[model samples]
Target chain A: MDKRILVIEDEEIIAEYYKKILQNAGYEVAIFYNGNDALQYYRQFHCPVVVTDLEMPQMSGEEVIGNIKEIDDDQVIVVVTSYYDPATIINIMKKNVYDYIVKPIEPVEFGATIKRAFESAEYRKMKKALEQERILKLERQIEWFNWHESIIQRNYDRVDRELFSNLHESFNQGAGFGSLLTLIRLIASMAKKSNGNYVIDEQMFELIKKNADVAEKILNIFSELVIIMNRTFEFEKVSVMELHSLLRMIIAEIEKYAGIKKMKIALSEQKPPYKSAYVNIESDYIKKAFHEIFMNALKFSKPSTAVMVFVDMKTEGVEILIINTPEIIREGVVGIPVEYENLLFEPFFRIAKVVYEEFETSDYGLGLTLVEKIVRKHGGSISIANILDSSDISRASETKVCVRVWLPLASEASRGERKGA
Target chain B: MDFKKAAESMQLPLDDYLSLVQKFLERLPQYREGIFSAKNSGDMKRLAAEAHKLKGVALNLRFEELAECAKKIEIIAKGEAQIADDVFGMLEHLIMEIKQLMLAKENRDG
Candidate 1:
């Protein structure tokens, strides 16, 4: 608990009176002659309780209260004024000020009011902490529910039937179903005919190779899904790295993919101060997360346009924004509308069909969902939004999709080292 | 003025009460000049503000008559009441009387 109280009063006599009384009551008191100076001090070092005189020179006490509340809405303020009008008191109370004391104050009553204000501040702090914990618990519950729902909703059966039916059709038009058993019997018959030679004709070998490739691809997807669902990373594997350097590396790795789509990955230049912004992460998992984001950006971007990447430093974290002008913009086309933004990270909720090589596979829509899980496991957050172009005269155009990821900054020591390096 | 009763009402020891009174008297000329200047300049807002300050300190120190006089000036300057021609003169006389009373008490204590 902070025992410091800030007293803002223009009258030196009154200020000194407050200081003396509060100090005698065992509170550390800081006195400012005006609201401006008091607020300036408050921005740097916050005192839980503020006692302000409503009439002051540079900034009125009401302005002071409003500004302080802007900085921290829960800041406890007690207004001290010489005279009070009922309307004035009502207006100040609307600002959520704890209480106001009319001057010519009774000392004991003044002290008691201050005590109650501190108690309220303490209670507010506890309530905020509890609320945050509750939110975190609810988020975890939602994640669990979504994971189980994806599994229980017959996603595996649907994917299996679709893939087997497609493979059966490709093998032969009349190979109705049970494609796996038919293919296995075909392989065994071929092996028996080879009879220790294991030789096959060129056309037969090509057909088997194509089927094997598709099977391997499906196996890989399911393997990744299982790993994401079950694995917990070891904390010891986490390392601190400058975010700009990591982003530059990711961009370098994905530039080839972007180039294949006739798109460019343009990374913003790292400013000097923010070059030292470091984050603690399991580099491989974080790399995979950004790779998924960049790949999605490239896959959806318009030809010859740039997928822009920006890294910005926030108060307690670093934010990465990936912006791309998408290729699809027509009504009812494959685009994330504002209303559907929250569902973008839900498992198996893909909005667009991605064409791989010459065919479109059931994409499972887990790219972003997996990325979200990885980021959240490392105590970061990810969100996507469709940016609308309001500058157009005729209609609002959905111009771009922005994927933002925020990761908590590493310790000061790591940042200092990066700066030195 | 009853010094004992005023000090008791302020919940201050006699010595502490006398010290605060001395401090108030030291600031008396500045307070008087501020009110007089605001009134002469026809800046009723400043006049009301100055009077409000004086009224607050006087009330806190249990200077009942002085507080009442300052309050009237504040109300009149705020345009809530009509200003009397003799009000300023009355305020000056009350201030002088308080100063004399403090001086007499100081001499008697020494």
Candidate 2:
């Protein structure tokens, strides 16, 4: 009984044609002879379905629809128009109406259309009700968490402090040497099992053990940096570090997070003589900067795509390119508009077309902004660009977006060493 | 055209259906006047709009001949069909036929 249909038609007889059939079907029906009255009635009564003729006096059907959608984005409207061309019809379909009927419709077809509109409206109402309920529950949970956040934070901080301190002490004392060696031996045996043709000779085992030691030392260096970063914010010391090793370590850590989504991280091999280039950077700040940039590449890319990191040296500085395919943007889902290219680096700015429900707990649109700030602090520049090609039609969906970073080369350290020599 | 059958199919009474026909007959003169003024001023957009409305209304009332004439005029005025000077004359002829039928029906019923 609550279900109602509003019919808006300029022609009185055609309006009556709809009214007679709809009213006989045991549904409440209201007739408006013009779009203005229809819109006013819609604002007042909010009918579940609207059957409107496309042409009317004082207001066209398109204008009425646009205005009504402004009021209620989910309103279901069925357009009935006698006049249309191929182009006009295509444009009308893109307006996102419920359905459309040409002139000279029979009673049966009209009745079926009404029935479908009613069913769709009911379904939408049910979904909206459920969504509202879920939102209410989440709000309550968030409120409770906010109330107890201080205590939760204090306990988490205590656990982190104790864990990293013990971790730093173990590395300093070389306490895990025996366990590390045993783990390396286990890996070598597993490799031998996987490849039955390979011989389990002592010489090969020695080589594996040597490689494992190098890995452990690199890991210990990373652990030390994490410990110092946690303890203080000041950049205490600047040292020359291998750029590729730093990048490789950060990529390995980030790969663990991407593993949940089956994503891949790839680093292009640095060509010949420049394979192991060094940069003089504060250990903590450089690690933080790389972590922030790499994690963003992981977060924004589709789960199936690979994130690529390419490094090379330029006359001006060391250039790093982080490239990945962004989530495919469809018609309704909000995407980053080209006009917002520069604005994306502004603090707290987020793309309008992002599906908020999909990324409900993502960073407060501050990841890119933070990366930009840190890059600028380190005398570096970062720019974002859409990678597209007009020549390849097949690669349209794989449009790669690249974030490029250029950091000033640490020439001072190299110059000081040369002078000492 | 069968007014009784049209009304029955619509689930409407014969009296209500005849009243709709009478209302359409009453508005014919104003529609003709508007179409003439639009044509005189070379307002094809206005002519197309008027003719499109007429076409829909005529079909609903089972004025088949009038509806066909209005449909032609509508397409021509909207520049969808080739413009022929005879279309206006054809619409006028159909309007006269409808007026004659309405007068005859009213006389017989009265």
Which candidate has the highest lDDT of all?
1
- Please report, as a residue range, the 10-residue window in candidate 1 chain A with the lowest summed lDDT: A170-179
State the TM-score for model 2: 0.46
Pairs that collide, model 1: none
Interface Cα RMSD per model, in Å?
1.6, 1.8
For model 1, how does the per-residue alpha-carbon lDDT over A1-421 read when each residue is reduced to its tens digit? 4678999998887787778678878899999998778889999878879999898888999999999999989998999887578998989989999999998888888989998887666545434543454465477877756765766464657545544554444334222123445566776677544455765556756665666665565567658767756776543222223556777898898777776777877666566767455566666878888888888887777878767777667788877878777877455654465444666676556555444441133244557777888888767899886654332222344356778799877666664233210
In model 1, state the lDDT of residue A31: 96
Candidate 2 lDDT over A1-421, as tens digits, reads 1468899988877887788778878888999998888888888888888888887778988988888889877777888877556676677777878888877766788889888787666545433443454465477877755754655565656545544543444333322344456556775666565355755567656765764564465465446444543443333222223666678888887777677567877765545535434444555566777887777676677777667777767775787877666765555432344444565676445543242323222333445665676666556788775553222222243355677788766564553232210
Candidate 2 docking classification: acceptable
Q: Which stretches of candidate 1 lie over 4 Å from their true place?
A: A136-421
Per-candidate clashes come to 0, 1
Retained true contacts (fraction), each candidate: 0.40, 0.68
- Please state the CAPRI-style docking class of candidate 1: acceptable
Question: For residue A31, what is the lDDT in candidate 2?
Answer: 96
Which candidate gets the maximum DockQ versus the true structure? Answer: 2
